[model samples]
Target: MPDRILVPVDGSPLSKRALEVACDEYGTAEITALHVIDPTEPGYSIFGVEYDPSTAPRHGSEAWYERATELADELFEELDALADEHGVSIRTETVVGRPDREIISYATDEDVDQIIVGSHGRGEESRLLLGSVTEAVAFRAPVRVSLIR
Candidate 1:
């Protein structure tokens, strides 16, 4: 088993499953959960919040970042509880950037031995145009990568 494992979380069911696998299978390893906020997709709302241009904060503004941070906090709370259930303690980080790049950079800079990431089953056409984060990380990461779909 890897001594250090990185897990990228996005509050998706597959991401949650990836975390579960990491905690269950690599419980002894040092685990880190990374959440990336893509500034390019400023209109993206993951918490089921309706995106109303009139009411929503301006994209890339301070208020938008604050809202993203708040959402990240909510995600971490749930992840922490899940890790607790598995008797595993994980460090959490939230960064603003593209998910794939951030994940790969973290693994390389932090010297993570392995990465467990979720695959968002995107359709072939969609993937051809914009590859999934899992695909990017798996291809560019220096360490081993395990995918959970």
Candidate 2:
């Protein structure tokens, strides 16, 4: 069994499913939740037409950074609540970088034994069978990758 499982949560239902699976299958192991911020994300603002309303700050602005931090905190809070419900403890981390690279890098740097991630995120790639980020992580991660739909 993996001593630690790293899960990347992006507030998407699929990612949430991944988290749920990690908690269910590895309740005794350490679990870490990671959230990454992509500065170049198109239409990142809450008012943008490309994405759902996030009440997010203007993309690339100072307020955007602040909002990102705030959102990260809230994300962790939600994860903590989920963990509590499952009788598990989850450590959360937030970073500013490409999601795939950050997820793989964290697993490598922290020596995590496995990664449980969603097949897709909150992006347009859902139409694809596998999200680009998830595909990259599965191919590049030094540790084992378990993808949940």
Instruction: Name model 1 segments beyond 4 Å from true.
Output: 44-49, 123-131
Can you list the residue pairs that collide in candidate 2? none
Show the colliding residue pairs in model 1: none
How far residue 117's Cα lies from its native spot in candidate 1, in Å, is 0.4
lDDT, residue 66, model 2? 75
| lDDT of candidate 1 at residue 110, scale 0 to 100 | 97
List model 2 lDDT by residue over 93-123, tens digit each.
8888888888989999999999998885445
Model 1 lDDT per residue over 11-107, tens place: 8888899999999999999999999888998555353546676887998889988988888889999999999999999999998888899999999
* Candidate 2, superposed: residue stretches over 4 Å from native: 42-56, 121-127
Best by lDDT: 1
lDDT for every model? 0.86, 0.82
What's model 1's lDDT at 26?
A: 95
